[model samples]
Target: MAATITNTVIDLSHHNTKPDFAKAAADGLQGVIHKATQGQSGVDPTYAPRRPKAEAAGLLWGAYHFGTGSDGVKQAEHFLKTVGPDHASMLLVLDLEGNPTGPSMTLEEARAFVTHVRAVTGRWPGLYSGHYVKELLHAQKDPVLGQCWFWLAQYGPTPVVPPAWAKWTFWQYTDGAIGPGPHEVPGIGACDRDKFNGDAAKLTTFWKAGGV
Candidate 1:
């Protein structure tokens, strides 16, 4: 069955402030996935501190790596080393949007990267990308790539499930500021907002399933 989409979450990076995770949690966020590393070299300085703080505040913690079309093995190594095996209790995502200014990842590169990360971590990292990129990659039929849980990014009133996906595990519904409304969260100002496919109890069960 398709998991029902509900619950609010947020993602952060160096671009945002050192978040007041307590404030975020009090504001009712279920989780936070932060940028851990990018390409083969860049690491988010805040990730080290923010991770523990987010956990302390009772938010499920996740980490993501931005693909730069670099050596897949090296990039995966950097990501794993930075986020560390202990900290990723919720999910590890492969930010597969590719470089905005440069070329996006080819299907082969995406597969290689995800494959290497899964080999090392023993868990398949969730695949994150926009709808267009999902279509470009032909994700539904690619044997190696299709195994990942999809985190679809589409800005709209409602999220559209990507091709071949029964449902998306995570949906990045907006990059705008979350706010004055009842659903507007504090601490995370003008950042990307996401939705889990299920409610809190279901999310916990899904997390415990270890990205299966």
Candidate 2:
């Protein structure tokens, strides 16, 4: 069956302060995905501590790695080492964005990074990228990478899933401040808001299934 898309979620990093995950959950967020590592060496300082807070809030917590397009295997190794094997019940995302100071990654490089992470974690890492990057990856027609789930990033009223994806598992719809009235998020100011492709129960199932 095609997944039902409705619930809201949020992705945060060290750029934002320690959030009140309980308040966020009360405010209608179903899950939280945090930036755990960047490149092959950079680690988010808040991830280790904040992750537990998110979990305690009864939110499905996940982690992502910002790709540098360098050595995919080593980068995956770094991410695995940092997040550890305990994340079997949560999502694993590969954040593929344009690096302002680095060269763009070829499809092979991207696939290698994702595949290596999957091999180590035994969970398929969801691909998170904007439209252009998604299109580029789609053109490669990679069996391994193309089979993974997608988290499409677009800032508008409606999110457009890339043609390569059968369906988008997550959609980041707003990077601006959003909430009831002008309050932005309860604890996080000017955050990226997202929509899970399913409801709360399905999200819990997805998390337990390791994102399939």
Candidate 3:
């Protein structure tokens, strides 16, 4: 299946079984955003180990934290510590989706998390969410969160972008099971795929700028 966007990105976690970053790059995959931590306790375990391999394969690397009901400040601390420093071009993200097993993070908590991230990193992390944020921030703009780049997660024909931002910085079109075609990637089958709202050069700049 072919996508309208030229720059493609794939997000992964412990749930993803195998990840051949070299093959994924050969298949036109430009980047990988893997889960880093959850709440203040849970760590992805695979995040650190996979970082070098993904980068060595010539794929842009990224790390994201799954927000929980725990203290956002604490979660941010744990997340950054787990992911280490960005070094230069590594992308950092905050997954703000509604959690099933644990309590979902409130909008206030979400704000705090991003704020702390910026405080530590000197750059706001990309925010990843779907209907959870869509409904939560319907027609309203959060001053703090708005500073962070939006990573819309909508498995549909068109993304129902939140009103806070005019458009999405990165749109998660599929999660392997839903959204558009080619839900599976070359190395990692049946995973989340994202479309950057820019060309290859712009995507590289976005990564280097952290969230431009």
Candidate 4:
């Protein structure tokens, strides 16, 4: 049941430092998703600075907000304000993992956040999580959350797709040391890597469509 990686995309934040987008492009990296904001107050300082650089390298750009225990609508507003207009080319995501910094976001809050995001952006943001999501959502079906594309975060051999989603759109198979190899990218030595469910052209279309 282990997933095979196509190595077309990657996701990063300030934690991985600045990457060499030129090298990454040469390495066949098609897109890059980075952390834009975390909670209401937290923002990734590197978000705006590296965007054009990544685009210059011909990599599709994306931003994700790490959900926190706050007013979901306000969080969505803050996330959109930070990310700017969608323009139909940039991917937007909701990171639904446990919040180590504070209280984790409840399913209710996440529902509100994603719904508000869809209401404002005219599209549903992708949802990124792993075991936490599986545990919470395994037995339940969420028509609202299910509308968003599922980005599976699994470091193990095989990933679990929650009952709400039929399958995963993107799989985060590694976080540097875990999951499958070749974990090293051209610019980044060891960082987060993901695989799309299709070929290069499909991946491009997916990115261009903002994971629609």
lDDT values, one for every candidate: 0.77, 0.79, 0.86, 0.88
Deviation in Å, model 3, residue 154 alpha carbon: 0.5
RMSD for each of the candidates = 2.8, 2.8, 2.4, 1.9
TM-score rank order: 4, 3, 2, 1
Best by lDDT: 4
Clashes of 2: 1
- Please, what is the TM-score per model? 0.88, 0.89, 0.95, 0.95
TM-score of 1: 0.88
Arranged by lDDT, best first: 4, 3, 2, 1
Tens-digit lDDT string for candidate 2 (1-212): 86577656788999888688888778877778899998889899999999888889888888999888688888889988999878778888888888777765556777888899777877679999886576675554558777779998877666666666777788887775442222256766568877787777887788778898
Residue 144's lDDT within candidate 2 is: 73
Position 163, candidate 1: lDDT = 67
lDDT (Cα, tens digit) per residue for candidate 3, span 1-212? 54335547989999998799999989888889999899998998898899899989988888999999989999999988888775447788989988999799999899999999888878888899888887788879889888888899888888777888777889889889988876888888889889888788788788877665
Stretches off by above 4 angstroms in model 3 are 1-4
What is the Å distance of residue 156 in model 4 from its true position?
A: 1.5
lDDT of 4 by residue, 1-212 (tens): 75444668899999987699999899888999999998987899999999999999888999999999888888898999999875478889999989887999988899999999999878999999988887777778898999999999998877678899988989999998988876889887798989888778888888898778
Q: Give the TM-score of candidate 2.
A: 0.89
Residue pairs in collision within model 2:
5-197
Question: What are the clashing pairs of model 3?
Answer: none
Error of 2 at 98 (Å): 0.2
